[model samples]
Target: MFRISQYLRELAQAQATGSYPTPRERHAKGPVVIWNLIRRCNLTCKHCYALSADHDYAGELSLPEVFTVMDDLKAFGVPALILSGGEPLLRPDLFEIAARARDLGFYTGLSTNGTLIDAPMAARIAGAGFDYVGISLDGLKPTHDKFRRLDGAFDRSLAAIRHLATHNVKVGLRFTMTALNAHDLPALLQLMQDEGANKFYFSHLNYAGRGNIHRDKDAHHQATRTAMDLLFDHAWAAAQAGSLDDYVSGNNDADGPYLLQWVRQHLPQWEEALRQRLVAWGGNASGQMVANIDNLGHVHPDTMWWHHDLGSVRARPFSQIWNDTSDPLMAGLKQRPRPVQGRCASCQYLSICNGNTRVRAQQLTGNPWFEDPGCYLSDAEVGAVSTPFETPANKHARRTIEIAHV
Candidate 1:
C-alpha cells in the first residue's frame, strides 16, 4: 500500500536503521493476515475479488475452527487481523470473532460493504472495538448502484457511513478504481470530507475473480495518472489545511514510484530523502509481510492470490504453512528480488515496487514472474526497455524532461 497522505504530510520521518529505515522495509515480526470470515454477500458487486454470491458457501471454517486459527495467529506473532469476506457483516459470528480477537490482543479491522451497516449495526461495530472499518463505495449513487447491481445500494451505504461516524467508529472509504468509477473519485473524496470519514483507500482494480472477467474496465494508464495527480493534490492541500485524514492506494505498487515522481516535480528538495524512504518501504510485501486466509482456512501469499493455495490451516498450522516455503510459489514470493522477467527484470526502481503485482503477470501470461500488465509506468520512468502500453502523453513528458536536461 502507498501511504499518500503520510508521504505528502510527512506524518513521520523515515527511521533510518541501517539501510532500511521504514518499518515496512524492515523485516516484520509477522505477517498481517486478511482473513475472509465468510463467502456470503448481500450484493453481487461487479468487481468482487472474492466472487461472492448471496448464498452461503459450503465447507467454510466453523466457529471452533476460526477460534483455533485466531489462537494460532496470535501465538505466531501476527500483528493485525483484517476481517473481510463476500461481506464480513454477513458472517453470523462476526462480532464474536472480533471481540475474541481483541481479547487476544490483536489489532483487528473490518472490511465490509456498508449497505448492511445501519445505525444499530454501526453501534454494534463500535462496541466490538474494531481499530478500523473500511466500506467499499464504487462511485456516486447512480454509478455505485450500477456497479453493485442493486438499487438503493448507494443510499444504504451512504447511510452506513453516517451511522459509523455517529457511533465514533473510525470509518474509511475503500474505492476500487476502474474505468467505470474513476470519474467519481473527486466526488468520493468530497464525500469523505462531508461524511467525516477518517481515511480514503484508492485501490487499483486487480485482475482477480470477477475483476478478471471485466478486465476491460481497468482504467487506462493515462486515466490512472490523472487520478493519482488529483489524489496527490488533494492530500497535500488537506495537510496544509491541517486535516489529519489518511489516504492509501493498494493492488498496484507502481503508485510508490509514481508518488516519487510527483515529489520530484513538486517538492524537488526532498526527492532524495523520499527515494531512500521508498527503498526502505520495500515495494510489495506479498508473501512476506502480507498474507491471506480464505473462509475455508486456506492460506495464500496475499488476498489477490486466492487461486493459489499455499496450505490449509486445518491440515497444517498457519505458522508452519507460512514459514515452510516448500511450495514453489511461496518460495518465489519470499525471495527478496523475485525472479521476475521482461520489463520488471530490468526496472531501475525494482526496490521500490518489487515488480509491481505478480498476480497480474500470472493472470495474463501464465507466469508468476512476468511483468505486471497493469503497470502504468513508461519505459522512461522505470528506466527499462520500451513499454508496450506507453501513452502519447508519456512520450511528451519524456521529451520535455530530455529538453530540460540539455
Candidate 2:
C-alpha cells in the first residue's frame, strides 16, 4: 500500500527514523496477514476477488480451528491481522475470533462490506477493540448499487459508516476503482470529508476471480493517472491543513513512482529525498512481507495469489511454510531483484515497483515474472527508452523457466 498522506505529511520524520511504509525492522519479524475468516457474503460484488457468494463454503475453518491459526500467527511474530471474508460479519464467530486476536495483541482490523454493520454490530466491533474497520464502497448510490447489484446497498453501507463513526470506531472507506466508478472518485473524496472518515483507500483493480472475468472494466491508464493526480492533490492539501486522515492506495505498486513523479512536478525540492526513501521501501513484498490465510487455512504469498498456494497452515506452521523458500514460486518471489522479464527488467524505477503485481502477469501471460500489463508508466518516465527489447525467443525462454519452476 502507498501511504500517500503519510508520505506527504510525515516524510521527513519517516526518513529520519526509518519508519516508512514497508518498514525493514517490522518486516524482519513477519508479514502482515490478511486472514479470510469465512467465504460467505451477502452482497455479490462484481469485482469480488474471492468470487464469494452468500452460501457457506464447505470446509471453512471453525471457531476452534481459527483459534489454532491465531495462536500460530501470533507465535510466528505476525504483527497484524486484517480479518476479512466474502463478508466477515456473516461468520457466527466473527467477534469471538476478533476478540481472541485482540487478546493476543495482534493489531486486528476488520475488512467488511459495511452493509452488515448496524448499530449493534458497530458496538460489538468497537468493543472488540479493532484497530480499524475498512468498509468497501465502490461509488455513489446509483453507481455503487449498479456495481454491487443491490438497489439499497449504497444506503446500507453509508449508514454503516455513520454507525461506526457514532461508536467512535475508526472507519475507512475502501474503493476498488474501475471504469464504471472512476468518475465517482471526486464525489467519494467529498463523501469521506463529509462523513469524517479516518481513511480513504483507493484500490486498483486486479485480474483475479470475478475481477479477471471483468478485466475490461478496469480503469483506463489515463484515468488511473488522473485519479492518482487527484489523490496527490487531496493528500497534499490535507497535509498542509493539518488533517491527519490517512490516504492510501493498493494493488498497483507503480503508485510509489507515480507519487514521486507527482512530487517532482509539484514539490520538486523533496524529490531526491523521497526517491531515496522509496528505494529503501523496496517495493512489493508479496511472498515475504505480506501474506494471506484463506478461510480454509491455505496460505498465499498475498491475497492476490489465491491461485498459488505455498502450503496449508493446517499442514504446517505459517512460519515454517513462509521461511521454507523451497517452493520455486516462493523462492522466486522472495528473491531480491526478482527475475522479472520484458520492460520491467530494464525500467529504472524497477526498485520502486518490483515489477508491479506479478499475479496480473501470471493471469495474462501464464508467467508470473513477465512484465505486468497494469504498469501504466511510460518507457520515458521509467528511463527504459534505450534498453534492449525483449524478443519472442526471450519470452519463450522465460515461459519455459516458469513452467519448469511450477
Candidate 3:
C-alpha cells in the first residue's frame, strides 16, 4: 500500500511536470502538502526560516485540528501529506497521526531532523505505514554540524537514513544553502553522489524564522550566480551520468523559476501543464490542501505546494505578512530596496528572477531583492540571459556539495 502511494505520487508528479495535460480532464486537485504539525524544533541552526524552536508552540493544533485539516484536504482532492514540525518525531502523538493519515488512504509521510529517530521510533514510523521518509541532511558530518549547530546530528541522521534504507522505504534529501559554508558546494554535491539519493532538493536560505535574525543572513557570503550555475551544471551532468534520475525539485527564487522556465522552454510541449501544476500546487497551495480530507479518511493526490506557492514575485499581502501567500511574500520582497541601476529592468531575466530573496537584498544592501551592484550574481542576471540556456544554473550547481543545513 505504501509503495503504491509513492508510485502514484511520482507518476503524478512526472505527468504534471511533463507539460502534458492530465489524461483525465478531471485531475486530482493536489498530489501532496506539508503539515507544519508544530513550529517546534530541537536544533538552533545558523539560517532557519522557522528560526529556532523559540516560537510559542504550547498551543499546538489539537488532533481535532489535524482531522479537520485532513477533512478539508480531502474535499480539495489532495492525496498526500507530509507531517512536519520543529522535528515531527518530537510530537508524542506522531504515531497516531501517521496511522490516521495512512488509514485515511493518504500517501502519508514525515519530514524530520532525525535527532529523535531512535530504533523504536524508526520501527514505529515504518509500522505507521508512511509512504516515504524525508530527512534533513545538509552535508557530510563536519559541514552539516557547522550549519545545523548540532555536533552529533550528522551521525544520528545517518543512523536514521540507514534505518530507512534498510526498510522498504523511499528516502529523500534536503539541502538548505547558507553563507557560512557557501564555498563548499563541491563537497556538498559529493554527498549526494555518495548517497545515491533518490530525490534531492537545494533551497536558498529564506528570510524567515531565526533566518530573520542577522546571523541567518548569507546574502553577502552566499554564492548567488556562481554557485547556482555550478550546481545546475553539475546536477544536469549527474542526471545524464545516471547518478540521479528521480528529478530534483525546490522553490528557490534564485534558481527554481529560472531553471523551471528554461527546462520548460526547451521541453515546450509539456511546459504549460507543468507550470500550471507547479503554480497551483506549489508551497502556497496549503489552503487548497486543507480542504481535501474524505470521510472514511483515505487521502489521495498529496500536493507538494512549493511549485504553486510562488505564483507571483511582486504582489502584496491581504492580511498580515506571516499569513500571506508564498507568491505575494516572494513578490512583495522583490519591490524592496529598488535596483540601483536600470540594468536589471532592461535585463532579459528580470521577468523570471524574484530579484533575489527579500532578506538577501536587505542583508546585503538593507533592501529586499535589491541587487547588490558589487555582486556578480546581480550583474549576471542581465548579462548571460539568452532566449535559452542549456543549463539552469551552472555556477550554483557546481558550488554545492553534500552538507545538511536545510
lDDT against the true structure, per candidate, is 0.88, 0.87, 0.52
TM-score of each: 0.91, 0.92, 0.62
Candidate 1 collision pairs? none
Question: Tens digits of per-residue lDDT for model 2 on 1-406?
Answer: 7788878886544444565444334444888999988889998899998999989899988788788888888888899999999899989878888889889999988999898878998888889899999999999999999998999999999999999899899999999999989999999999999999999999999999889999998999999999999998898888777788989999999999999998888767678778987887778888978899999889998888899888887789888899987888889888888999888888989888787889998887778888888988888888764334355688799999999999
lDDT of 1 by residue, 1-406 (tens): 7889877766233222222234334434889999998999998999998989999899999999999999998888899999999899989888899999999999899998898888889899999999999998999999999999999999999999999888888999999999988999999999999899999999998989998899998999999999999999888887767678998999999999999999889867678888877887888989988999999999999999999999999999999999987899888888989898888989998989988899988887677887888889998889888434334577689899999999
| Best TM-score among the predictions, by candidate number | 2
Structural RMSD, model 2: 4.8
lDDT of 1: 0.88
* Candidate 2 deviant stretches above 4 angstroms: 11-28, 385-406
Candidate 2, run of 10 with poorest lDDT: 19-28
Give stretches of model 3 more than 4 Å off: 1-32, 54-56, 215-222, 241-244, 247-249, 256-380, 383-406
* Candidates ranked by lDDT: 1, 2, 3
Q: Is candidate 1 or candidate 3 better by TM-score?
A: 1
